[model samples]
Target: MTTAKETVAPSMLAADPLTDSVDWLLSKLGKHIVMAAPLGLGKPNRLLNAVYRRVAADPSLKLQLCTALSLDPPTGSSSIEKRFLGPFAERHFGKDYPRLDYTVAQRRGELPPNIVVEEFYVQSGAYLGARQAQRSYNSLNYTHVARAVASFRVRVLVQKVAREPGGTRLSLSCNPDLTFDLLTETEALGLPRPLLLAEVDPLLPYIGGTASVDPAFFDRVIDLPGPTPKLFALPREPVTDADFAIGLYASVLVKDGGTLQIGIGSLSDALCHALILRHTRNADYLQMLEALSPGLATCDLVQAQGGTGPFIQGLYGASEMVNDGFRSLHEAGILRRRVVDDIAVMQRLNSGNA
Candidate 1:
């Protein structure tokens, strides 16, 4: 374990497989470990479970998970739902997708007393009856999670990342939500930089905007030594009449040359579908709009704030979370407006200067 007093050149740091390095990590970080992981898809399940196992074996070793959205395969409760979801989960997650040890233990009411899991966000209704989960829940706003996690004085930071074949850069892929901010916040708190471990998976898409980072960012970039485990994926839900109606209504409120921020769900899918239709088939969209509500087409708010027309100038994505809806919008040529954080550059572009 590299300490605050030591210096190791960042780029030259070598990765060791977790199977052989868990003991090494424990030896380095000591038993009183405060670890951080990214929410949602960025968690490195195998790496985390290895550490969790260490604490479970020895009560003297203390472990506190400072993270959110600990994912588990969708195993339905009722017999009927289970029957339907069993095969589905297997198909998406494969037979050997490593389960988060804490999720399983918590749900089964067998979590070790020495291990504490503090999550600021969780899957909807995932822990309604799990007393341990409820007691350990940390209720913090999403925007403030970085600060809260930093306050834990995280000793290790483990997350999944994307890599281009034979390429040097690693991208946060599905989750860049809080990792960067956490680093900044940790520094602001006058704490040592956490031990950064990057888990590489082939399934993660190589996304560019604000997601890409240099190799030096990580202390080690490790991958599962054998056949790679499948990343957890949720099947897309079918759109319904109510979803379409809400989507159409929401579509009219989106200005053509504005920005958009949407999350994954049937409603967001429907909205993206409606936006594509508004661009590709304007006449049919108008017909549906009139059928849904004749007055909505003439609403003063809609008229001024937005328009029921194709997006010629396109829209920009200003969201922290990225999903398939944004991908579909980009494919349809409606999500083409790129943005930059530089104020002067934006002003120059807006003023039509080279």
Candidate 2:
């Protein structure tokens, strides 16, 4: 939130997600709302709902929602499926996890005429049956998401953030990727600066490196009082035999010193597990590779590009979406390479002189 001199803290002072955030947003951006939300766990569900409810009630107000990977707790089709999935959703996602209002409304075909939702990516097969979601899907390259969102003249960026020590500094902990890039892109294009908004959730780990940010970055912020909201956690799918085989074959292709990136899910989990096994238990890993298929161990691609060895040098992680995959890697000491943003430092590192 804007600096309030009356308060002791420079900013990041407490405010109501329902009233304060929505009211300030309307005041800053006017009735016509164009906003972007981060993918997955970084979305501010409560704040977004507040805004959605306000705009949906008024026929004069307009909203164009741009985002990717709109996450929703799964509700099974059949009664049997619902019985199993109902508790599964609650166990993985907390008892009172808030789902996006607009997404639910849109999926139900009850979204108001004034409100439009656009997404470049959706959960695999989540919206295949929903005609409106498919029709309104904003197809574009992953690298161009920020530009695509900006192209629609989006003027508000709302993201979930975490505290950076002493509760003064803020980090776009889960979603530094888009917020940092979008603002840079918008400025490069010489457009009016977007009203950057954030909802602080202290539960999120305070990540450093590129994710570390200052409180001054936000135009407005709301740290809702406790009982803090529980972030929607994706249930871990059991790693299948096919997944392990794929991960093993894929593992050999990675050199000892290299950059690694992985998406979320059982497959990525399998890969990270394989990599760790390869490093920590080389014999067992190699045995599993051979057992899966003799041809995999002797494959030319595996021979040329990868090998059955521990990552003594480790790997640098650089991916669009950093989630649990990266976390596992970090914990295992496989993601120890520090790739700084400085070009000179990178050049030196690339030249093998760092």
Candidate 3:
């Protein structure tokens, strides 16, 4: 009596050859497919490359590449910023993801009439602000991925992940954020049960929290044997003195043991650093705060809620991105709180009654 998980695991393990698994999945899928975006180290590059090859062979198949943050090779523009960053990006990324097939075809206006790309977010490059990209972009919220999936009748879902060697469980790695939502919506709508394909690359980091999946969830699995795409790295912006002061002042407003939802970029980095300083170097942090806001340190709110004291319970990171700054705080033993997404639970936690 084999359970679904047992059945699926053995079948996936038996489908060893990458091309065989890919061809099998492709045969099961409809002409239209939706893929998760961003060249996270976990992205199924080999599977995606195979899909592009298939699309190339079959000119009549309308394969729409729907996703966000499609990465591009750095442009060798004459602008000073481009001139400075271009070589650095080349040195770092090399020819790893030289070009995504659809991106290249779209840019060259050479896409077969049946192939198109729809992106919700574009890379922050010269092309991003251009009229064409702005017009073509979907401007859909991340929450609406399921809606888009149903609307587009997306018949296949391909995701990449980290697999425990010889284990049936898989980690969504960097993108569990949207995978669950998309899966739920697809199921709820009773859309044609899309073929679920998971690609495992050994190089992906196994991140916890809502990021894991079981073998039963995927219809097929392919193990890519090669160098995985390098993790996309964002250069840290230097924090200005004024920015530091502002961050110091802002840090005193957040109560200890509270949840934080921060966006990525320099300001968020500065705030995290300031919070670390307040927790570890109370006297110096107080001195800086006093100098910046005069009497802010002596305020009742600051006295009751905020203090130049080390976090005994630590803070929770509930940001859209668990970027390098969050990783830094985690390493420093600061961001250790975990908050669930239930409204009632959050209400109790906020009221300090949980």
Question: Candidate 2: misplaced stretches above 4 Å?
Answer: 1-17, 295-299, 342-344
Candidate 3 residue-wise lDDT at 134: 53
Model 3 CA deviation exceeding 4 Å by range: 1-22, 34-42, 78-87, 108-110, 126-132, 298-313, 341-354
Mind giving the per-residue lDDT tens digits that candidate 3 earns over 69-185?
Answer: 766666554799787977788677765753567666655556676666677866666354344345557887766765775566666667777775666678887667666666677
Query: Order the candidates by lDDT, highest first — what do you get?
Result: 1, 2, 3
Return the top candidate by lDDT: 1
lDDT for model 1, on a 0 to 1 scale? 0.84
Residue 345 local lDDT, model 1: 90
Residue-wise lDDT of candidate 1 within 1-354, one digit each (tens)?
444222122233455466445665677688788889988788888889988987899998999898888889888879999999989888898989898999999887789999999998889989878999999999998889999899899988888888866787889886586888889999999999898878887788888767898867787676566677887887788999999999999999999879999988899999999999999999999999999999887899999998899997799987767688998999999998656779899777666683
TM-score of 2: 0.89
State the lDDT of candidate 2 residue by residue for 1-354, as single tens digits.
434311122244455546766777777778899999998888888888998999999999999999888889999889999999999788888888888998888787788989999989888877766777888998888889877777777899888888877756777887687877888888888898888888888788788877876677777666676577677777778999889878877888887778887887888988888998998888898888878878676678777887778877789987876678788888888888768889999888877899
Candidate 2, residue 14: how far the Cα is off, in Å: 12
Best of the two (2, 3) by lDDT = 2
Report how far off residue 91 is in candidate 2 (Å): 2.6
- Candidate 1 pairs with clashing backbones: none
Model 3 scores worst on lDDT over the 10 consecutive residues at: 1-10
